[model samples]
Each structure stands twice: as C-alpha cells, then as structure tokens.
Target: MLRTDYKPQSIRQSGQLLQRHSSRGFRWAFTGTIIGILLVILSFNSGSLADSHASQLSTEKNKISAEPAQQQLSADKAKASIKKLPRMNIELPPDTDGRLSQDQTDIADEYENAFPRRALPLSIETSLYDESADDENPNTLTAVTVQAGDSLARIFQKQSIPARDLQNIMSLGKPVKALTKMMPGTVIEFVRDRQNTLIQIRYPLDETDTLIIDKKASGYHSKIDQVKVETELVSVNGVINDSLFLSGKAAGLSDNLIMQLAGIFGWDIDFVLDIRKGDRFTVVYEKRYAAGEFLGNGAIVAAEFVNQGKSFRAVQFVDDKGNRNYFTPEGYSMRKAFLRAPLNFLYVSSGFKRKRFHPILKRVKAHRGIDYRAPKGTPVYAAGDGKVIRSGYNKYNGNYVFIKHGEKYVTKYLHFSRRKVRTGQRVKQGQTIGYVGMTGLAEAPHLHYEFLVNGVHRNPRTVKLPQARPIDKKHRTLFTASTRSLIARLDLEDRIYLAQLDRINRQQAALSNSEISPKSAPQ
Candidate 1:
C-alpha cells in the first residue's frame, strides 16, 4: 500500500502543527523571564524602602537627644554662674508684713517656710555654744569613772584641769591620800570655773563617807563628810547536813559571814574536826543603812552554836577601854590561850602512839607528835602568842619551828616546805609560821605537831587549854544586863527552828508511808 498522493498533504499539516507548538513554547519562556525580572525589581524596592525608614527613625532619635543635651549645657552654665557670685554675711531687714529677718541674702524670703536649713556639724556647734555658756555661768561639774591604769594626773589632763590644781589638792596630805589610791569603778567629780580652773573635787570613800576638797583662800582644804547610818539586826539560822560552808551558803549566809562565825567560836571548837551532822547555828548581825538603802554588814551582835548536844552562846560587848570582845552570859571571855590545833588539816594521818609502825622506817617506834594530813603548802599557824626559839631544818625533822610560850609551854612544828618565822621572832596566836610539805622522814604532805609542858610531850588533842582573861568585875552587872536579851532571843529562834524541822520531818514521813502503802497492798 504505497499512497504517495496523500503523503504531501499530511506532511504539510504535521509541519504546521509543529510550528504552532514551537510558538507556544517561546511564549511560555518569555512570560517566565518577565515574572522573574519583576520579582527581582520588587525585592530591590522593598530593601530600599526599609533603609529609608530606618534612616528617618535615627534622624528623629538624634534630634530628640540634641534637645536634652542643650538643656543640660544651659543648666550647667547657670550653676557655674551661681557659684561665682560673692558671699556675704549681710542680714536682711524684715518687711512691713511681719516677716522674720534672715542672715543670708541668697535664700528666698519664703525659703524658711518651704524647706529646712542645713545644720552645722555637731562638734562645731557644741564647741561654740558650750564656750558661750561657760563664760556666762562659771561653775560646771564633770564626772569620770576611774578606769584601770588611770592616774589622777592623766584624768586631770583629759579634763583640761591644770597641774597646779592637782598639786594644791595633794598638799592637803593624808586626807587626800585616798585619791592617789583610787580603785577601779570609783567615780570622781571635778568642779571647774570658766577659766578651766579647778574649784573643788569630790571623792566618795565609802557608802557613808565622802571626802570633799575645796579651794579656799588658804590654799586647799579637805574634809570628810559622813552620812547618818541606821543599824538593823538581821537574824539567820541553819542546821548542818553536809559541811559548815555548804550549809551556811544554803541558809543564805555570805562567805564573810560564815568565816566570822567560825572565828567567833574557833577557840572552843575546831571547825574541821569538831563539826557533827546535826550541829546548828544562829546569828544576829548588824546591817547598816542610809536613807533606807542597805550599805553593808557591820558586826555580829550575838551568836549561838549547838554542837553534839552542847550549846555555846556569845555576845559582843565593848569594854570601857573601847576594846570589843565576845563574852558569855557569866561575864567570861570566849577566847582561850592556846588553840586545839595549830593548822587547818584534812584528817589525822597518824596519832601519837608509843608503839606504831613507821612507813619509812618499817619498824615500831615512839611517835610523840600527831601527823596532820593536809595539802602541800597549807598554812601552819602558831598555837599561842609566843617567841620563836628555834626555826631550822634537820635531817630527820626537816624544816621545823619551835615556839616557846612564857616559861612552861612549848610547841614544835615539823615537815614544812617553807618557813615564815625566824629564830627569836615574836609571833601572835593564829599567825602563819610555816607551810606543810613532804620533807625528810615524811611519806606525804603532812604537819607533825607536838605540844610540850616542862619538857614532857603531851597529846595536843586532850591537853587542857588555859582560859583567857574574863570581863572586868566592875562591868559584870552591865554585861549580864546587856547579854540577857540576846540569849533569850537565841533561845526563841532555836525553838522556832526545831518546830519547823519537826513539821517537815512529819510531812516527809507521811509522804513515804503513802508511797509504800500502795506497793505493799494485798492483791
């Protein structure tokens, strides 16, 4: 089937269709090219627009900042001009409107009402005002507490007082000597004039006495002024269960008061060895006061101590010679010639035994003295007022001291670490003669004490001591009359104490019975 005649016509139609497809492709390509060019132009225009907008904003911001900068410059210039103006202390007169005058002209008239004026420094104002006031009124008093290491001269210099004034005060001699020895916490007052000259000085010596030194026409004069003090009797009592110190403290007795009590009855009873469990004591002492304020304790008026079922009472009395002493109701003195023990001891380590084993010697020997166990360096006192006959150290006795009282009595002390007395030195009763130690022939720290009469050693514990001089016969009636009320008061206080103690004991027993009855009940 060769069809040559229809081939040309069909070919012409195909070629025309091809030419039309080519023209459509070219149109599509041209349209795409135009859209791409337009998109690029739009992007460039948007970028330029954003840049212009940002430049406008920045220009506005710069202009805004320039306004405040110019304002600040002008304000600074105004301040500089104000500072350059002259200052004067000229005061302004008040107007017809009843306004107050001001010392400064730069401030407005209404400135005082609107704002407060700045105050000057405290130190400057104080100096100026105080100077003026002192000139007007010359008298002024300055008080100072005496600090440690502060001398009178230093204190005076600190207060601007003249040295000549101190010399004048010191010229008064013994009356002003206390000022030189001023203790800490003492308050001293100085009176001065406008010229910084000292006029007077006041120092309180105690609660009731004050030493006042004043500048008079005759140099300086000093006088002690005493305040009237009222005496009050305070009674206190306590029973011992542990020790005198602890029981006295529990009864509200101060240490000084307890020691005073011990000293009053120390002649008859040894506090360390003679104290019992049920011993009781009552004391009436004087408390001094001024204007209803307590000053301090004065003296013990009367006291009673009951030991081991025996009661001892003493009352303080002043003799005609102005010597104060404690005496019994029978007009007898409470003091004795010799003390039972020469020193305060812990316990009796070794008694006076004719046949006893010695710790160091390891054999039975005659121990003529009592060994009193005590701490090292414990004070050893003289048993009676006597002269030291021998104070020396030996191989067996160690450091020893011998005191001879009159012609018949002699006391010996051995085993001392330190000797306080010398040979031929007179020592008072209760005076410290030596300190205890563990010397030669001693196993531990102890005091070996021996009492001799006519060269014969006697047991110090059982030896009878001599009584002191009694009250004078002329004052016997007065002593009895003055002491009777005190003794009766002591009896009354004892009865009251016994009653209270019985009541407490009954209450304790009842409580114990109640507690035990519940446990012992039958179930």
Candidate 2:
C-alpha cells in the first residue's frame, strides 16, 4: 500500500465516498459507516414517537395531510427544540419479486410518518404578518328606545357607554344631530364589543332614512342610508250610506285618506252639508312601502265624487319643481279662491239674518255672519289668499281676524279661542288664523264666518268668489303627461267600481226576490 497522510473529508466528500468505497480505506470508514446507520434508524424511531405525541397533544388542532414546503422549512429551522422530521435515506424494499408496488402504500405510510406535520390553519388568510386586525369586535347589538325626558347624554349613560364617545360621534355633523333630536318611541341602535366600547350607532331619521355612525381607526364616521320607498297606486270606492267616514272605514280606507278625500272634493262639494245618501266616490291614492313593509299612504293621485247627480273629477299633478296640486282634466286648479267656511263646521248654529234675536244680548239685531257650530279649538282658516289687515278683540267680536284679499274682497273670522297669526302677515288661503271659541257676544263654541265683497257683507256659502290661479303655462305640458295616464286609469277604475256596484245591487235584488213571496197568489 502506498503511504498516504490522513486528511479529514468534508460532509460533501463523505457523502460521495459512501456511494463508492475502496478496500484499502475500509478500517477508517467502518466506524463512520456504523454511526451513520444508527443515526438513520434513530431518526425514524423518533419521528414515529413524535408523530404519536403530536397527535396526542394537538387533538383539537386542525390537521392537514400534506404540509406546505414553506412551513416544512420553518419546522426544520426550529428542529432543535421541536421534534426532528427529516427525510430518511433508506431504500424502500419492493413488495413482490422484481415488481414495485404500484399503489406504493408502504412508501406513503413511511412518508406520512417521516415528517412532523404542522397544524395548518383552517382559515384562508395564512399570512404571518397581518397586524392591523380590529381589536374590538362589536358583538352585542342593543336597541335603546327613547322615552319621555330622555336626552342623548342620558341615553348613552344608561347604556353604560362613555359620553365622550357620543360626543365624538356627534362631531361628525348635521346627520349626527338627528340622534340628539330623537323623539319619543324612536330607536337608537348601538354596537359594542366585549369590553363595552361602542363601535357603531344607527339613528332612524324617518321611515325612509337612517343615519349610521361607525367607529374607525382614525375617528368616527357617518353616512345616511336612505331607504327606497315604493309607491303603489291603490283604488278605493264606496257609497255614502250614513257618513263619508263610515263608508270610508268599511271600504278599508285610513282616516288620513278619508280626510284627504274630503279635502280633494271640498272645493266642489260641501262634505258636511252635501254628502247625502246615494253619493259615491272613487279614489286612486298612493300607498308607500319601504322594504316590502307598509309605511303609509302618500297622496291622492285621482279622485271622483258623484254628488247630487253631478260628477266632480280631480287629479293630483306634480310639476318639475316638485310642487303638487289638484286640478281638473282641463288644467283648472281644484282649489278655489276661498273656502266656503273658515273652519270645519259640525252644524249650522245660526244663519245670517237681518233681524235675529241675539241670545246673549237678548235683543234683535242684524247678524252679519253665518255662525258655524264646531268643537272649541277647531282650526279657523284664512278662507282666501290675503293679508291680515286687522287682528284684535272687541266687545262684539272677540279675537277677530279681518283679511283683505286684493282690494275687492275681504273675509273675517271671529270668536277664536287661540289666534295663530299676527296682523300684517301675508297669509295663504286655508291657512289657520285662529281656533274656534265662545267669545264676546257668542253663546257657544262656533266660528262666525263672513265673506265681504267691496266691504259689503255677503253670504259665505252662496257668494261667487274669485277663481284660483290655473296651472302655469310651462307646467301644462308636464301636468298633461303625468295626469293623462292617471286619468285613464281613474276612468277605468271608476267603470270597474260601477260594474261591481251594479253586480252587488243585482245580487241583492235576486236575494230580495228570493226572500219575498207572490202574496200567496192573491188568496
């Protein structure tokens, strides 16, 4: 053997030398060979034991069949403290003679045991560096109802929420002020975390609007969430048997709708004195809905009233400026120049007479105005678009209001319990000026209504007043377009209602015939 000085080989050289060996260097390599085999066997045994131990410890931890290469590398870096899961060098034996197992079940089993699988997260966000997550997760949702004498500060204090938070939220602006002005029975929603810090708030402005305030990392944020309301046209028809209110109720109409119906036809017909038996009306109105939930009726789209064999039709028209008013099909305004009576009357307590015995004075005098008996505090309207020329009290007419409608017309309202307007204030027709009351020279709560033409007292009920302004020329086109479809639908609905009424009458007639006998054949 040639003399050769021993030089230690590196790990790379040793790995290459293991693949091919020579007999001259067998002694020095024998110990290294035995130690490498022992290490390989110890690694497999430790892996098996570590696998069982990890499974025992992390029974509740999420498990995955295949570990990602990145995590496996991480596991390798931490192998000193953790269990070693390195791949082995042993060659897997064939299952059959010169034939490898196609299924490789044995190899798969060894591979599964060879590495320590990490408990993979079941979540998709597996990033190790996402530190901006919210610490306060609002979980508890509370809806605090506003009661009488409750302020926003008190509400927040009651909820155990910091008043500072409420102040911070209110700093967001006008939309947030809606919360501070919550009415009785309104709801204010709050979202808080486990630590009881308020994260969000919602204040409903109306049926179709809500103000939302949210807590962000920077500061409190707010936005208005306006809910879209659906408008559905609904038609209701009824015959006046006893009263319009009774008939409307039976026809499934709300008091608001019933009042609206009376108002629409009030210019043409006197609802108090003109609504009689055989009177029928058909109304197409707007029914509002928010998120499929009923909100309320909006406006009367079209209405038809047959009073005393005379049919009065009116359709609501909205112009481009969003101003809405009722008008006839010919574009004449349905609102007259003046209301027949300044206040709603229950009955005619006294008529205008030249020589009428005064109840309080016990003397005969010329009663200048018609006395309309109504409930005390009932509103008194202006009756015409005018200015308040005089508003004062007197011995004869207490709390009197005299309005000058142009130079030719004047209207007066007397015996007011409460005056709502001041003198020299320009007032519109139907504007409330005062409330009905029994004042000087009055025996009961009634409105003494008078209409004067050129300073001469005239009958408010039978006088021919000036006409209301017609629809503007620019709005005529839009009004015609909007009302055209509504008018057609109104007519169709009216016809359908008439047919239904006729069918009902026929059914009743047949029932009457069935109920009646032929007088026993005149026996």
Candidate topping TM-score: 2
Q: Please write out the lDDT profile of model 1 over residues 1-523, one tens digit for every residue.
A: 8876665878989999999999999999999999999999999998887676566556645544565532433456556644743333444456635543453432553233223232222223454565555466668888999999999999989997778888878887898999889999999998877676778889999988999988888788999999999998889998889888899999888888998898889888878778999999999998999998988888888999999989988899986778888987677788788888888788899988888998888999989989999999999999999999999998899999999999999999999999999999999999999999988789899999999999999998878888768888898877888778888888888899999999999999999988885456676
Best by lDDT: 1
Candidate 2 Cα lDDT to native? 0.82
Q: Give the per-residue lDDT digits (tens) of candidate 2, residues 415-496.
A: 8988888889999978888999988778889988888898898877778867767899989888888899989987898789
Candidate 2 residues lying further than 4 Å off, grouped into runs, are: 1-139, 160-181, 193-199, 214-223, 497-523
Candidate 2 clash pair list: none
Q: Which ten residues in a row have the lowest lDDT in candidate 1?
A: 114-123
Per-prediction TM-score: 0.64, 0.69
